[model samples]
Target: MGGLSPAKRLYQTIIHQYSRTINCNSSNHLAQRLIQEPISRIKTTLDSETVNKSGDENLEFSWDSLLTCVHHHSPPKAQLVLEWRLEKLLKEKEKNENLYSDLIHLCGKIHDPQTAMRVFTSMESNHGGKPSSNVLDALISAHLSSNNMVTALSIFETMQNSDDYKPTAHTYNLFISAFANLGNSKAMLAWYSAKIASGFLADLDAYGALILGSVKLKRFEDAEKFYGEMLEARIKPNAVVLHSMLVGFCEQKDLVKIRGFLKGVLEHKWRIDGYMAEKLIGFYCELKLVEEMEWVLVALTETNHNQDLDTVSQIHNGLIRFYAKLDRLDDMEYSVGRMLKQGASFRSHKDVENVLCSYFRAGAYDRLDVFLEFIKDSHELARSSYELLVAGYRRAGLCEKVDLVIKDLETQRKE
Candidate 1:
């Protein structure tokens, strides 16, 4: 069905593939299948035709693997499939707040808060279930996520007035974290104050929110103070808290602090994703701390299981950027060679352009020949490698040294 929407297509596929096993009239097991398994193994209990009824024969159908082949896709696409499935299942399931809450959270994640609100409102009247704090959080998250401020606040007011439920510390932390993300430090601190006034001792989560807010607002001192308080209270900082503080320190170019804390992070081997890897590497490069940069790279390499290719690529590109900015052609070539040796890629076209621009800017036409020859000799350049050399010269994407590049590029392409 090329004409059908992605979600609708998934629904039809599931209907055709597993119609014998699923009961649309029952919600609980269906909802569990939606979440607990990918679409491939959504059916926990199989049919007689699918499995051996007498338990004497091993069925060789491999329906699960076949379904996996049908449904295997990117995470967001899979989530969309689940969302449509949940929407249909919600109408059939009753007296299961857990499922309802989970579906509401998924709605929030997928940016369909209106549907989440519909699911929330339907919980008691239609499903005969009393909504729990989990449901409340999901409902609030859905509204806040969509920036439906007035409606979200109205829901909060209703929760406050409810005799059956009261807003908990976790609830307030949700608001705090939301405001922090929205870059509204004032509102974030207001929620933090409200949380404290409610007599709930601020925990790691609450402090993490405050520090994140402080960092977003560039109030480095405030972030430091919150971090210090967290340590004093003997609450171990999680990745978010530490990363936020580290980011603030980096922005201020506080190399001393980065050195001390990064040591601990490496010692504990906390995971660093691409963005964080880029930031740390670029920060060290700014300070001309090449030895420290190398140390960090080596450490990351040693703990490379946590480092994805994108993360490793960014690390290499950051060094390339530093060298390009300074016209350190020899050092840049050496860094690139080292990266190739380590099996990391120079995937960023911007970095490649930066290198070409540097060569042009420095008038190092002779050295550029060696650099180009060095890269071409690697024998693994992607398709755009020639375009950046040949097409770049033809289009003036790089200038002042085009003749030699063009000649060499044409020769390389022919051979």
Candidate 2:
């Protein structure tokens, strides 16, 4: 076994081990042990024996085990293992499409597009093998992974010109996704149009990328247009895409469009998630659309029974903060009550500060006293709250009240 090449030695070791195990144990037990054995251990064992081995030997290598290591281990080591295997395969004049594809994909995974391209080039010239579409796709994907869009597109063009390969919807989606991630709306749309012209209908992922890219570019109208096209094509928008569109509308501050779009969503009985509901309430409050805000809040409270507690607390705090800013103490108190009913602690320091300031600014001493008492009973008053109260009293020429607040703060700090 030591006289044999590393690949042959590895094969012999596996065969001997398997034969010995099978003879002593039941087949089921042997199968279970093999299934439970970690691929990492196997790869490590092979790596320890194979390192420094020459590729002059024409022994067969287990590509599957090597590929597994390439995916799950360090890229540099995996690449070395792959290169070693490729050299052996080449020396034996064996052509394996899967091995070449995995090599290209690993290069991409490691962001080594140069090595990936070299592997691709050598597949035909050095290995005398025709590159399949899958291999080309891997090469293109590798370039895209590195954000080398120019090289990726060049390879894609090459693939298109080749008689043996044609780009799939997946390939086009990668371009759209890359451009979208770069926030290049123009390029993304151009590619989208090209995809459509190539007689391939845009999939859900393609539409999502286009919608997001348009939104990032502040092209709300175009985003809506793409959404409409999605609807017409009967391609349902997922929660993520819908939220992106809503966010785009909010950014554009087109209240009419948001209202109409939301109305349509409700009319069509589309699912409105907690995040979307929160955004709607926030935007409505920002626009001072009290009626719309109230409607949405009511619907959200009713529908979001099973929603996350943190999100519900955030929505309540948002409403309280908004109402406090407008000096609507009654509405603010109402929101606070709702928040408390949900078993949420009043934790937003900003909202507490805003309400306190609003009361002091409006000379509503009675309301301010009530709020202070409430905070005291709830034990939610921090040292910062006392400081803010003292500042407010001092600003209002209430020197005695300021002194009292300072004393209270000192007592609380000691406690």
Error of 1 at 227 (Å): 2.4
User: Please, what are the lDDT tens digits per residue for candidate 1 over residues 274-323?
Assistant: 66786787678767877777777777788776557677777777888888
Estimate TM-scores for all models. Answer: 0.64, 0.60
Once fitted onto the true fold, the runs of candidate 2 whose alpha carbons sit more than 4 angstroms away are 1-147, 161-165, 180-190, 193-200, 216-221, 232-234, 263-286, 305-309, 343-347, 375-379, 394-415
Tens-digit lDDT track of model 2 for 1-415: 5576433333233234333432312323322333444645533544444444564332244444544444454555455544554555466565777777877786776666666756665566444445666776787788788787666776676557655567878788889988998998878988888889989998899999988888888888888888998999989888878899999989988778877877666656576677886787678776888777766656556665445566556666777778889988898878777777767656666678888988987899877887778666544676677889888888889988888888887787788
In model 1, which regions exceed 4 Å deviation? 1-87, 110-114, 148-154, 157-163, 182-187, 193-204, 231-239, 281-295, 298-312, 349-379, 391-415
Clashing pairs in 1: none
In candidate 2 the C-alpha lDDT for residue 76 amounts to 52
Determine which window of 10 residues in candidate 2 has minimal summed lDDT.
Answer: 22-31
Q: Weakest 10 consecutive residues, lDDT, candidate 1?
A: 17-26
